[model samples]
Target: MQAQIENTAGKRLWIKLSAVAVVVALAVGGYMSMSNTHAAPDVSFTNLKGEQVSLKSMRGKVVMVNFWATSCTTCVAEMPQMVQTYNAYKDKGLDYVAVAMSYDQPNYVVNFVQTRSLPFQVTLDTQSKLADAFGDVRLTPTTFVIDKQGNIIKRYVGEPKFAELHALLDKALAT
Candidate 1:
């Protein structure tokens, strides 16, 4: 009955592994749920023009802090809509900061902006400090819409939703 004993031992090992996996999954889910409810971190970084920008400076305006990369297709696709949103609300003190995570050099970002004709303040996260500060962003095109009081109103980790973004801005403006 050696074979029978070995089979039973293997089943027991499998069951133990499954239990550990479930426990880990539950812990991770709980951590993420709690983290999502908190306000985003406040961090400062430099724009392509060498201007130091922080969340504090944009305090009285609805700010869109977008994390993107030159190689990300989804980030490129959202540029036009971002431009539209900026144009529509810039007069009302809306600010858009496109923080490039991949290409840190100013020339690279400047060229990208020039080629795309993107109308917004393009910045560089040289060491990805801002990205790390906000969250461990593992994907491109992550965005955070901060309200006038510097609170993170909403966050999107993928392609931007213009309607949701506009709604947040509208609410911030109304207040």
Candidate 2:
């Protein structure tokens, strides 16, 4: 009878410990999900026109920062869409900046911008500081969508689907 009681007590303890473990696991999971999105680093960019633009100043606006290189075909192909996206949302409080990689020739970028008549801000990362600030971005056409609150909402490593991107922009702008 004593052995039976001891066994019952042990089983109850085991169940209680298991419940505590589960609760802890759930709490950790929730915390991780909540902390997934991080704030964008504060950085300044010099546009082609030699105007200084700081990310901190862009607060309260949905900003799109694209890291691109002139030699990248994909970057070239998606630029038109980027222009369209900027044109579509610029008046709705969206700010866009295209950062040419440090390796890209300034003349090439200037010529491309002039030929295309790109309306958004075009900046050159000549010292690569901007790239390092943006998570050491090495791939061409890497894009980051920052929410109005200055948190990085999404990152696209390659060409993003325009439709989905538009949907995300619409949702973000609505708020």
lDDT to native, each model: 0.83, 0.95
Predicted structure 1: lDDT:
0.83
Worst 10-residue lDDT window for candidate 1 reads 33-42
Lowest lDDT sum, 10 consecutive residues, model 2, at 32-41
> Residue 164 of candidate 1: its Cα lDDT?
75
Q: Residue 52 in model 2: shift from native, Å? A: 0.8
Which residue pairs in candidate 2 have backbone atoms (N, alpha carbon, C) closer than 3 angstroms, thus clashing?
none
Off by over 4 Å in 2: 1-31
Displacement of residue 55 (Cα, Å) in model 1 is: 1.3
Q: Candidate 2: lDDT of 168?
A: 88
The prediction achieving the highest lDDT against the true structure is 2
How many residue pairs clash in model 1? 0
Q: What is the TM-score of each candidate against the true structure?
A: 0.74, 0.86
In the range 1-175, model 1's lDDT, one tens digit per residue, is 9999999999999999999999999999998876564455777777767788787878888888899888789988888888899999999989889988855565777888999788888887777788888877758889988878787877899986678778878888878
